[model samples]
Target chain A: EPEVTQTPSHQVTQMGQEVILRCVPISNHLYFYWYRQILGQKVEFLVSFYNNEISEKSEIFDDQFSVERPDGSNFTLKIRSTKLEDSAMYFCASGTTNTGELFFGEGSRLTVL
Target chain B: TQLLEQSPQFLSIQEGENLTVYCNSSSVFSSLQWYRQEPGEGPVLLVTVVTGGEVKKLKRLTFQFGDARKDSSLHITAAQPGDTGLYLCAGAGTNFGNEKLTFGTGTRLTIIP
Candidate 1:
């Protein structure tokens, strides 16, 4: 089965540094999303992208966060300045239909110190 | 803001036991999905329930969508040790072309052999 793939399985960055998480969604998927889960917390929606632009975003997706589909296959999330609270597992997902059944990547664990 | 609450955050049971986990919300959803996640991995989609009062069975697991579309349940019969994982329920709203999903708090299950 085809699955979404993420790069940099684990990243450790200092406070105020920039970090970029990359994902390659399934080739035929039309919708993409970014979600995060803090340790011992529920998974939180960050943003959704379609047609090469963000369709919607949550409060957690502030100015410091940005998502780009620079190419047909690559979707990337960039954080301008990482904060300690930003430490979490970031997941990238994609779906071929609007039914909301998404396929998720293995996730990128970000550790801010 | 829409919120999904899951009951019994953690459960541990012996193999072959039957168990149920629930996801409830005040807001109605266009669809609901169940996912299972193991440690150090992203969530894998288990099932999706769209129509209200619809039931779907995957092997020994059965999923039900409430009549109001605001709740759902997962029941596993004759569960085995392989059933241990963190289960998450997510809901998608009725907005056209909106693919953002709101995830529930999650239920961590441990099946003991």
Candidate 2:
């Protein structure tokens, strides 16, 4: 079965550095999403994208965060300036229908030093 | 804000045992979904319940949505090693379905072999 795939399974970057997390969602999926889970915490929604634009975002998704579908297959989350609090497991997911049965990739562990 | 709280933050069971994880909240939801996440991996969707008092089954797993749509539960029968993982429940406004997913803190289950 087609699944979401994320690259750089682990990322380590210093504070104030820029980092990009990449994901290639299942082909033909119409909606894309980014979520992060702090160690021992709930998975929090970062943002959602559809129709090539952001549909919604959470407060955790602030100025430092941005998402783009640079090409037809790649969806990326960019952190302009990383912070200690930004260290978390970032997951990308996609769903073909509005029913919200999302398929998630094995997350990319981002460690902000 | 919608919040789904999963009970028994951690649970350990012997093989062939039955267990149930509960997800509850004070707010109503349009639909509820259950997901399982393994270490270092993103959550994999298990089942989604849409209507009040709805029930869904996947293999030895059973999922139910509360009558008020404010809670859900996942029950595993004769669980195996493969059933061990972090279980999460997400709720969202029905009308805005597929727009966003609000998640719970998650319940980590360990089925001892």
Candidate 3:
């Protein structure tokens, strides 16, 4: 079975530094998403991307967060200035359509000090 | 904003016990998905329920979508130690082509052998 893949299984960085998480979605999938889960908290949606642009974002997805599908295969999430609260497990997910079935990659754990 | 609330935040039972976890929401969804996440890993999709009052079974697990499309449930029969994990329920909005999933608070289950 094809699955989504993510880079940097774990990342630790100081507050106010830039961080980037990369994901390679399942081939032939058309929709992509970024979601985060704080320790002991529920998973929260950050943004969704389709057609090489963000289709929708949640209130938590502020100006500091940006997502790009730089190449056809790689989708990236960048945080310009990390905050202590940004520490969480970030998951990358992909789906072939709006049908709501998505495959997620093993998350990239980010710890900002 | 859509919200999914799951019941019995944590459960621990003997390996042969049968258990049920629920996911409920005030807002109707186009689809609802159940996922299982182990420590240090992203959520793995277990099943998706789309039509109202639909039921799907995957081996020892069974899933049901409420008639109103605002609630769903998962029942596991004769659970094994391997069934331990955090279970999350996600709901997709009725908006067409918008694939963002709003996740539930989650239910953590541990089956003791």
Candidate 4:
């Protein structure tokens, strides 16, 4: 089965540094999303992207966060300045249909110190 | 913000025992999905329930969508040790552009052999 793939399975960076997490969604998937889970907390939606633009975002997705579909296959999330609270597991998901069945990539664990 | 609350944050059961995990919310959703996540990995989609009062079975696992589309349940019959993982239920609203999902507080299950 085709699955979404992500780069940098684990990333550790200092506070106030820029970090980028990359994902390659399934070949034919149309919708993409980014979600984060703080340790011992529920997963929180960050942003959703479709048609090369952000469809919707949550309050947690503030100005410091940005998502881009640089190419047909690559979707990236950038955090301009990482905060200690930003340490979490970020997951990238893709779906071919609107039924909410998404395939998630192995998350990128971001550790800010 | 929509919140999905899952019952029994943690469960440990012996092999061959039956268990049910619930996901509930006050807001109605267009669809609900169940995912299983292992440690150090992203969630993997287990099933999607769209219509109200819908039921779907995958092998020994049975999923049910509530009549009001505001809740869901996963029941495993005679579960095996392989059924251990963190189970999450996500709800998708009727947003215009590829709806974003609101995830529930997860249920961590450990199946003892």
Q: Every model's DockQ, to 2 decimals?
A: 0.73, 0.73, 0.73, 0.71
True contacts kept of each: 0.75, 0.75, 0.72, 0.75
The i-RMS of every model, in angstroms, reads 1.6, 1.5, 1.5, 1.8
Cα RMSD (angstroms) for every candidate in the order listed = 1.0, 1.3, 1.0, 1.1
lDDT per residue for candidate 1 within A20-113, as digits (tens), equals: 9999999988999999999889889999998888989999999999999986889999999999999999999998665768899999999999
CAPRI docking class of candidate 4: medium
Least well predicted 10-residue stretch by lDDT in candidate 4 chain B: B92-101
Candidate 2: Cα lDDT at A59: 93
DockQ, prediction 1:
0.73
lDDT of 3 by residue, A9-109 (tens): 99999999999999999998999999999998998999999999999998989999999998799999999999999999999999976567888999999
**Could you give candidate 2's per-residue lDDT for residues B1-113 as a string of tens digits?**
88889998899999999999999999998888898888888888888898899999899999999999999999999999988889999887655546688899899999999
Candidate 3 chain A, poorest ten consecutive residues by summed lDDT: A95-104
CA shift at A54, candidate 4, in angstroms?
0.6
State the TM-score, rounded to 2 decimals, of chain A in model 4.
0.97
Worst 10 residues of 2 chain A by lDDT: A95-104
- Residue A51, candidate 4: how far off, in angstroms? 0.7
TM-score of each: 0.98, 0.95, 0.97, 0.97
Model 4 lDDT tens row, B2-112: 899999899999999999999999999999999999998999999999999999999999999999999999999998999999999999898623888889999999999
lDDT at position A13, candidate 1: 96
lDDT of candidates 1 onward, in order: 0.94, 0.90, 0.93, 0.93
By lDDT, highest first, what's the ranking?
1, 3, 4, 2
